[model samples]
Target: MNLLSFWIAHRADMLGAIAQHLTLTLVATIAAIAIAVPLGIVATRRPRLGTALLTFANIAQTVPSLAMFGFLVALPLLGGVGARSALLVLILYALLPIMRNTVAGIQGIDRAARDAGVALGMTPQQLLLQVELPLAMPTMVAGVRVAAVVGVGAATIAAAIGAGGLGDYIFRGLSMTEPTLILAGAVPAALLALAVDASLGWLERAMTPGAARSRRVTTRAMTVGGVVLLLIVMGGYAVSGRWGSRVIVGSKNFSEQVILGELLAQVIERTTDLSVERRLNLGGTFISDQALQSGAIDAYVEYTGTALTAIFHQPVLRDHVDVLERVTAAYAATGRAVLSPLGFNNTFAILIRAADAQRLNLTTISDAAPHTPGWKAAFGYEFLEREDGYKGLVRTYGLRFAGTPHVMDLTLSYRALAGGSVDLIAGEATSGLIKGLDLYMLEDDRRYFPPYHAIPVVRTETLAAHPELRTAIERLAGRISEEAMRQMNYDVDVSRRDVTVVAREFLDTVLQSP
Candidate 1:
């Protein structure tokens, strides 16, 4: 779709996303400024404390955004899922810029200025407030500008925590390989950042004593800037829609999971009276599992293999029924239910671009194994760590890449492979991208990988609270065949169909049949 048409179609959602993005940035910036300014001042005054304080902020900056978000999720009270954790991480990410700038701004002031203020009989406080602060305003504002922009980008990651923002579109687009959708999120974010930076620049200029500008220009800047800031603050309150008496369904940040989440959500919504709150594009397994445990989400689609190995920490079993039964029994103790398998095993498969596969005459993992030493392979974070993933596969085949495999989000692996940036990737056997992108999955002739039958997992407590939900959801069991799922995925990922449409259509046709 054209930019205007896209915006028109998703105007409300975009408005809400932009609002949440702005609010996240604004709140984090304000909080960081409040804490950082004092810390910066104290550090400036006492040089010894500066080292420790700066070091602490540097350590926070060093933590990767995703890792930090995950770490914070485990923290008691202060850390959990949603906007709270997102804001806290963003504040931490934003502190260094503001704090460093604050210190530099104050330290850079001329010694003569302080001496002059003292000679004029100004108290220490008075000198700081009148002379130093005014002189340092420009530099400090620059720090705020940097922090604001940084926060904007970081806020996109907040979507992973159920803190909605433009990243939702960017991530969804990435998974579906839709550039227009990515741009829908990206263009607005860039514009928002530019708007913020320009407004802050105007404010910085206005703060400078000798900066020349017309009153009209200053007034215009102030008016536009104030409106934008106000919209952010107000929009945040509006965008965080309430979820009273609703079933929250979450999904991992990938095309398949999102489609499955929509499937479950559509089933529940259609079969029962309860509303469905979609928390799609969330972070990986841990994030979703934690959200489920904490009752932040009611249900989500999960794979038996992922639950068996990653969540339960169990050894691989060849028997599909045994694996499902074992996982279900283990989850029962935790008050979660592993529903019936969704009639497909979306097992992990090693994939290469179709042309490359054809050229090398590689038809199986073993066939490709010999050439792996010269090829660069990319894998998802979970795939890199899971026993059934890269480690075992490489061991089983005695294959090693030219260098350490590139680890990234699962969805991005498809993009990387399609772009020819990576020679091979760990992909789902049933991913629509396999057919859509003209990629070929290398056969697991050695049987290193275990079964990964898709299933719907729900909180037992939610089932009890709304007993009808059980009946509503169970209707989908053993309905989606492997071929059917791949086509559904292809429809969404390749044809660029809306997930809700695909899901709802499936539910209407399949589940409603006699």
Candidate 2:
């Protein structure tokens, strides 16, 4: 489907996503401005303090927004999963621009104006409120405007953490390889950014002294337009909830996640008589989990490794059964239940081009690490920075190579390895596609990586109300062997078959037959 048709068909979701995106960006920007403005005023008086504050803000800006989200999600006080964590990360991202601008605006004000205020019997506070602030308003507002746009853009990544936004469509599109779905998200997000930037610009200009009243009126009109657009988005979501009969399901953006979510939705509809609507391809594991918690989705597939490391902050494990049991127990305490595992472990496996492996006689991650120093190593975005990711492993093994490393998505890493562009890829799953590409997984003789079993996870509340749901889902769990997962992934990722169709067939074969 084209972008226009996809928007029309899924307008309600698009609208809801936009609402979420705006709400997150606005709240973060407003908070950032409130905090930064005061700090900016303080810094204007104490230039040294301003330097210290700016340094911290700049450092914060270097931290990846997603990594910040993950760090916040693990914190006990400010983190609780879903939009809360996403919001915290957005706020952090907004701080530098807003804070820096506030300081700059205050310091940039004509010094003579402040002297005039003091001569006119004004106190420091009075001078700041009457002279410096008003004169500096335009610059400060510009900073806020920049922060707002950056917040909105960064908030799209929040979708990866379960903060629903226009990014949902884009990530879903990416997973499903549907360009139209991607545009459904990208177009609205870009438009929203523009709309917000324009409105803020007008507000800034309107506040300036000697600015024409006609310009102020035009600015007012732009603000009104933005408000109306926001209202329309909210109204669309309300209408969708009232009239839409579909149960919108979603999945993380990956082959296995899409397959499992599609399978579960199909089973739920066929076996429980519930209407089903699929919204698969929703980004990463944390994003999928957050979506379910926020009621953006009913459920999605997750792995024991992700739950333990990314979600729970536990140490990695090598024993499959032990990891599964620990993860199931931990998640259960949070009122979430893990349906039986799919008997297959898709743990992170390091893979090399057949030619490279043969040339170097590399047989494990450690062995590959030495050659990696001299050869380019490619990894997924997360794997490159994660503490337990490639860098950690490389350090642990004390291996050095000669080439610079690059990071890309997991799928892209596979292609790069096959095309002889990368010497090694750190995290690959045991699937047919890698095999088909003439690559081989090196044995981790030391078993450094954690066990990652495919499993169906559902909210405990859902299972409590419908006990039979567990059985229906578990029937498919552990039933899908390694070979089966490989074939299914091949069908969707390599052969280009529809995921829903493949899921339906698999469900019928497993659940319907005697």
Candidate 3:
């Protein structure tokens, strides 16, 4: 009932997600059909070309979906952040099935039927249109069915890049740790895929040779379906910005990031006339950075040390003010203005199960280092790969476990340790899940990690366009203390409260204060 009530209350968002999802699937599948059918036909005539085509399709089909999205985000004119890039990735995935089926369908035609057409004084084009296409129609439609269903599932990931779909709710749900939101997005998408499969399957059956009279009817319906989908894509593409009001804001995919993203949006809403368009739960720091740099979003919160080292590739600085100064300057050089710190330092912490800490009398990294050979450990992908992350920490502490550090999502790592799936993890200092789940943070005795004060990174152009933003952001300066942020993260991650409500309540209290 909680999920149902929430769904009903936010039916507008749910409906919009469905529309965006349908549009992405329809557009990609239709565009795939337009390209694939011709290529499939030509490949049937050219033996060598057919081999090369299949090889290329197979290679493209094998590239991971997230990697493909990242690849496209770097391409010029044709790609960036949004539906265009997502459409291209979806079309690439849709191609192999559609093309392979088209070639198979055409080549699978009976030789006797072709001979009859030739004997009946039919031209090559006439034979192809009358005999070949009709016979191949059913199989080709099967390909379309597969591609459409695949596109629907893949479209959910598109939300990671700011392309609105059922995925937006799914990612948001994961960040908030709310199963209700997940179902709100996922259940609709699954049903949509089944609906597409059934509808296309019916059409494929209707195109059989015995149903000649209904052939044109089904084909016309197919064309109409494509046109309807294209219209939906255009009509709603600009509207329904998933709680957006313009001035797009984005954030990395995690509880803290989502709350901060909403914090910025709500602050903008309260201080300025321009409505904020949020694109939160992005894949990670890189995706959020790419979106901001590409102008897909106007602003997002970034960590000072992360910007200094991870993004700028500069060496780490231990002093908090020094790291902030260097990060702000580096961002300014790249046309991004880094604002005042939000008054929280979320440096990485080596965490252990509280039980283990108590049993082993572990109070610091050095104390836990001796027993590491018996314990399993894990870290987030960013941590494992970063200059300030796992590699450096291990070298600094010489802490060796029984095996190598397992890579896991930052948020999930907390629960994994608590649940005894792993004995150790690198977690954020301010993560609410730490206290909520009874996990213990070992002291960073080596001080290997740098200060990671949170600050808003906004485009210089966006600031100039909306001068009011400077003051609005300044309102947040030195505002969110470490304790306040931890409690808010706990409210969402542990208490399971809505992020928007938490951000709004915080803002209400902040504005009412002297």
Candidate 4:
């Protein structure tokens, strides 16, 4: 579809996402300037302190973005699954460029300018303000431009913490395999970055000495200042919990989780008077679990196998019922309630292109064994390290790929497999893309895989506070089947239907049924 049509279809959501994206980038960029500029100035004045500050800032840059967000989530005041932690992480990521530029801009000055100012009986502060600052403004603006652009890109990841941004659309689009949705988020973001760089570039040029003059600089300065003020005002709305005090439904950043989350949110919104705060598009199982425990989110859908192996770190169980029981018991200790199963199992399935699968006569893990040595496998980052994931599967089948496995986002794995960049991928069994892409899921003939039953795991405190929520949520138990969910997935991913619309339609049909 064209951009105009896509915009017409998703105007409100896209606009909201763009606004949040800007709020995150601007707030973080402003904070980085507040911290880094002073640090940069201080570093230029004091060599030892500058060295220490720069080292610390460098260390912050070294931490992976998601990992840094996770680390901050565990801290006392900073720990949460919202804009607060996201803002803090973005500040850390943005520090290096701004700080380094500040130091370089000041230190780049010629010694004669400093001596001349001093000889003219100017105070140190006056020299800095009048002579040095004017000279350094161009460089400082350059640094801010880099940081601002970087902030725009990095802010996309903030959606992982329920800090809504354009990344939400991108993640949803990836899961749905809809390029339009992806572009909707991506194009705006890229444009926003260019706009920032261009506007800043104009300012940088206008601020330089001996440059041609017009009323342009003043107009541009006002334009930039107005934009910054607007973002700050929008950011205040985000931080103030303007989304409402309803039951917050959280989900991992994937298609299935998004579908499931919308299901829960829609159901609650239908059955109760309370509004639902969608903290969807959260990161991994670990992040969601932390958010739940810390009360940043009240409820989310999780799989039995993920809870068993990834969360509890226990051995894989054989029986589906036994796995559910064990997982429930484990979560109970932490004052969380694991509700009844949602009647479908979304097991991890090893997949390859249907044509490749047919050519190799591959119906099971063993059938793919002969092709393994020549094939490159791709998997999500979590799958690479999970106990019940890559290591155990490779060991069980004695399979070896042509090279090291390609670790990527689960959604990217599907795209890569489709594009023939990789020969095989680990895909979730219930994913719509499995059918849409015509990939064959190789069976675990030796029972190496465990059942991943869909279930709602809610915080005990939330239940206590609103007992009706439990009743409303549990109503969905046994409502969805494997085939039903696969069809829903297909509708969203292949047919490009909206997730909320799909969920509402399904819930409508179910509720209308005898």
CA-only RMSD, every prediction: 3.8, 5.9, 2.6, 3.6
Give each model a TM-score: 0.85, 0.72, 0.93, 0.86
- Residue 209 accuracy (lDDT) in model 4: 76
Residues 8-73, model 4: lDDT tens digits:
876666666777888889889999999999999899999999999999999998888877777777
Model 3, range 1-514, lDDT digits (tens) per residue?
9878887877756666778899899889999999999889989999799889888988999999988888888788887888899999999999999999999999999999999999999999999999998899899999999999999999999998888789998988876668988988989899999989988987998987798767777778879887876665555544455444478889899999999999998898898888777788877888888889989899999998888888999997899888888888888998999888888899888899888899989999999988998889988988888899878888899889988878877888888898888899999899898899998999988788999999999999999988999889879888899899999999999998888899999999887786
Clashing pairs in 4: none
**Count of clashing pairs, candidate 3:** 1
TM-score of model 1 relative to the true fold? 0.85
Per-residue alpha-carbon lDDT of candidate 1 for residues 1-514, written as tens digits (9 for 90 to 100): 5767888876766777887788888899999999998899999999989889999999999999988888888887888778899999999988888889889999999999999999999998998899988899889999999999989888887887887789888878877767888899999898988987987887777767776564467778688777977876566445444335788899988888998998888888888998777788887888888888877788998898999989989998778889989999988999998887889999998999999889989899899988989888899988888867777777889988999999887777887898888999989988898998889999989788778999898999999899998888889888989998999989988888878789988888887686
Encode model 2's per-residue lDDT on 413-490: one tens digit a residue.
777888888777875474656766788888876777787788787887767666777776777766777777888887
Higher lDDT: candidate 2 or 3? 3
Model 2 segments more than 4 A misplaced: 45-48, 107-131, 169-184, 236-253, 265-300, 303-336, 343-408, 422-453, 459-462, 465-484, 495-514
- In terms of lDDT, model 3 sits at 0.88
Where's the lowest-lDDT run of ten residues in candidate 3?
A: 236-245
- Candidate 3: misplaced stretches above 4 Å? 74-79, 116-122, 212-245
Displacement of the residue 453 alpha carbon in candidate 3, Å: 0.6
Q: Using TM-score, give the best candidate's number.
A: 3
Error of 2 at 463 (Å): 3.2
